[model samples]
Target: MITDRHYEIIVYGATPGGIGAAVAAARRGRRTLLLEPSPYIGGMMTSGLGRTDIDWLDASGAIYREFAHRVEAHYTAQYGTASPEAEACNRGMFFEPSVARAILEDMLAAESRLTLVRRSELLSAEAVDGRLTAIAIETEAGEGEWQGRSALSADVFIDGTYEGDLAAMAGVPYEVGRESRDEWNEEYAGVLYMNFGPSKEVLPGSTGEGDDRIQAYNYRLCLTDVPENRVAPGKPASYNREEYASLSVDAAEGRVRSIRDVLNILPVPGGKTDTNNHHYCMCSSDLPEENGTYLEGGREERQRVRDRHRHYYQGLLWFLQHDESLPEAFREDAQRWGYAADEFADTDNFPPQLYVREGRRILGEYRFTENDARLAPGLGRSPIHADSVAVGAYAIDSHATRKREAAGRNVALEGFLGLGWLTEVYQIPYGVMVPLGVDGLLVPVAVSATHMGLGTIRMEPCWMQLGYAAGVAADLAIAGGAAPRDIPIDNLQDELLAADQLIGFYRDIDASGLMGKAIQYFGAKGAFRSYEARPDEPLTVERASALLALARLLPGGSRFPALPAAGAVLPAGADMGPRLPREEPSPAAYWQRHPLLTQGLAGRWLQAAGRALSAGTAGAAGGSVSASAAARASSPAAAWLRTDSAAAAEGGPSASGGAGEAAPAVSVGEWCALLYGLLLEARRAGSSGSGGR
Candidate 1:
């Protein structure tokens, strides 16, 4: 039997990006429907990704910020501080998967307009003249048809599934596998061969001749150290380690270990550790043979892959926990963390979905390439319109495509490449989210754009921001009676900027209003403020902490205080002294010449301030100015003093100011003096800022 329901918007996947998109759509007062093939809401976060590989937290938008806040709230309520390690292990922001699931579900429930259907699969979709007309879904109860899935028959449909299944089914053209350099004229697009092992031994089956070979995929496993909560490795019904026997043997022989071996273990406060599961094309458990086939495979074949992953992860666990071949210290450390009691109970201890790093990326009208990333020095202008949605920072990290052993050694290309550590953050245009010819459908994840582009945009926060943008575009399409791709760039830009989405890093700012609040928050906390905030620039560890401190979100108060007056200048022979090349310009000098960098700095400072204010400082008065003026004012020296004065003046509770007024000017020295006064005022007012003291 088939039943029918109507909704203004339909979001598939239930991944973090899906949840964000659904919430965004619902919040816009759309009659939204969120369908999850799995039982839980958070696809990765709540599955087993306790340790996050967040690339650009500085550029993460409100949707992601809300998610982070919930995580902080969970810890604060339980441990009185955001640092979980303070209560137990040295855990930072890691959380139990179940807790993340609960938070996402709770957030969904709070929105009365959103409908959540769990264990529901999108069987098929019907479109008319480029617009999605209806979708047929299968659930436990029975099959059902959803009509007007978006406003006016889904004015815009967002594909949030990690696998890009919906987009593929909808007849959208998408690309799978890496593109050869010849195709995109990109330096980093083709197959790369690198030596990852300690020695320079060349192993056969390790080198690749082409880029057709795809990277391996794996299930992110959640492990724990507690014996009572520990679950032993279980063999999959279709257990067959023979296929992987060679790799296992090599790993045992210390020739090749799973990426897990190099995992950067993030310790939780309570003695637990969050292990990151990274994948490379040639590494252990990457399952290269399983690429592209996941969506097309029959249920049995799919289950087989799942079984293989289970066995692989199980074998991995056994090796980590009890393998005598491993060093004693390694074995002991591996046994410290096990599955959390409250998470993924049904799977015995595994996430439901395998982390699909890349899927069928939609072949949208405009394909972003490395050229777009490195935009030629003097291209007339970018085909990428001004409507940008998200920012990306991760390197172009493509894994090996084949396995080989040669010259009595096994070698693979598994390390990161492209735009090394010093690469600037890249802006993702709204066009990447819009599909060509497909009127209603928009892909926020695993859709459209080049393979190299995916390297940076694959992070969770970036995905969430893209999802948010998709939702807003859907709303605009519904209200204005236009297709997603046809939603004028000007209108899209206005809405995105209004919503606080950082687009282009250069064009938007309400700096005085928000930047001041940020300065005040961090200044009062005695935290080191980055002399300048540039959105397009990659965030260094130092700057990240500074921003966190400014937002009052850092676990502890300022880690670095203002340098003593006498020691402010670089010491003679100091390696840390300014190391800019003689012919090259400093960041300050570059900002002066590049309006984009200037705008980026203004927007970032304002964004930092906005976060600080929203975290709970009262408003500071200031009038609006053109982004140009804000950009000009963000020069290093001026920016520092401006931020310093603002931070000093409103460092306390009950700060308020109306638009356009200068408020009150406090000199840098006077600002420092006011810090003590601000502390007293905050204490008296019982403000949250007092918590830092």
Candidate 2:
């Protein structure tokens, strides 16, 4: 029976961002309705792309880290950490697709405030006076489309679907294709391809102004070479020998060698590989002129497109492995690989979700353009943002927008664009998550960004981060009885900071452990007033000194005394503790920039602070700190720091010679823990030695 339902928060789609939004909102005491079209929850992670594409770990925020830790625990519990399975899982960096799905399912089931409905799709949405009021959903009843439909009213809504269906139904403006270069002043925008390159030659319509050309979509296949756990590729229902005519020609001419050569086979847990298309159209899986149509079409149409892709790709796989028309060597090499036995058993070893590379992007209030992604002349970093809700470090990565043939050469266009590695992490503004002139709705997955800009922000981590932020924003708005856009940004930042969300990288604190409070404390004292440290980027001497001064300053007191009058430097051949590994190299060149905080200097300063505090001259511990303060700086939270410090003190790189390693830069979190931990330890020692002094 279809019935009208009311929810405080309605999250459409079970994409990672949607799951994140739903979990966050429910955890915050709001009634959340999480709807998904499929039976499974995880999108691609549960489908086949098990290896996470996370680059900037610090930028992923608290929830993501929490999820990662849980995955690690799962492995440790089941496989004893040292087992090959656990090692292959790599602590959530790689895992089985089913494992990813199971985790998401557990998360959903554990949340009491979240109501999840699988096999339900959002049909339409209603918005009045710029605020979305309610939405309609079509549920599956047995095996028929006539399943009763239902209406849902919610205070806030999130469109986390890759297709952006809810946002479209709500009448929010969106773009479906690449923008013209002049439209957003993005150099990589518009139709970009080489006129004479082997992959993308001067084909008709090869390089033209922007059109409704969406990037190619593919299923992230999980395959294994192990005969026991592998299923041989068989002929699809729509198999055609004609499809291999062109490919066979390329193979006979030596342009194509073994099928494995044109496939991206990334190793995952249990010896399985996440396979996808490589160069020269081996598994590009892109269908031109159909993607745009599917974006605008209904769920049924989208399903058809997805099915067509599966059939075509499956047929291509069968042809490569079975067809005798191809070279015997290539065919035999292809025979070694087959579908993973443990993945997607429900779909006959095929992935459930289609890897929709590009889709409807919300025309957000503040559109992120390529200019926001531009590298600083020689530096590989982009400009920073004050209103950053999340950070993304991945370069602009886009697959092929279109494929064609020109001058008897197969050509793919506008496929790959990258800045390789960034000099600094880029900030994604909060405004990008809000659709322009739309209220009570946050489009985290299909966020507002130019085609070129979306290249970096479209990753799963960025989406999940944005979705988590959206959930917080929704909760804040509900509590304040105000629109999401009307909430004071300062208050938002405060709330985000309280939850350990990465709004900005102040004092080298990326919201890891109890670092936020420490960073915020030093930030409040103007120690890091002018500095914005990059993710994992080392701190300079001046920056480190500034932070240390703040830590040493007595609360309620004004002035900071100068550094302990130039401590004696250790001369060559001096006995420096045990030998350790080389120091890690800092991101920037030391001579070109300021002096870095070496491990030796950091240890010496820590030892000096401890000595000074024990002598009763350093500073006072004030009235009281937060009850959770100790836990925040507890050893477990700061274990990595201690390990590094121990290594450094033991004639490590800072003491001995370790060339081209990372210079020991004290993180804001580490410095805070060190300062507090040392003071506490020294106080204990002082009290033990004193006889009622």
Instruction: Give TM-scores for every candidate, taking all chains together and pairing residue i with residue i.
Output: 0.67, 0.74
**Model number with the top lDDT:** 2
Q: Which 10 successive residues of model 2 have the least lDDT summed?
A: 684-693
Residue 463, model 1: lDDT of 84
lDDT (Cα, tens digit) per residue for candidate 1, span 22-135: 888999999998888766677777766676656544545557767766776777777776454434311223666776777888999999889887767777888888777777
* Model 2, position 451: C-alpha lDDT score: 77
Scored against the true structure, residue 192 in model 2 reaches a CA lDDT of: 64
Runs in model 2 deviating more than 4 A are: 1-4, 142-147, 194-208, 280-283, 376-380, 407-414, 421-424, 505-693
Candidate 2 lDDT tens digits, 587-643: 334323435555555554544343344344434222112212343356323444332
Once model 2 is optimally superposed onto the true structure by TM-score, how far is the C-alpha of residue 662 displaced, in angstroms? 31
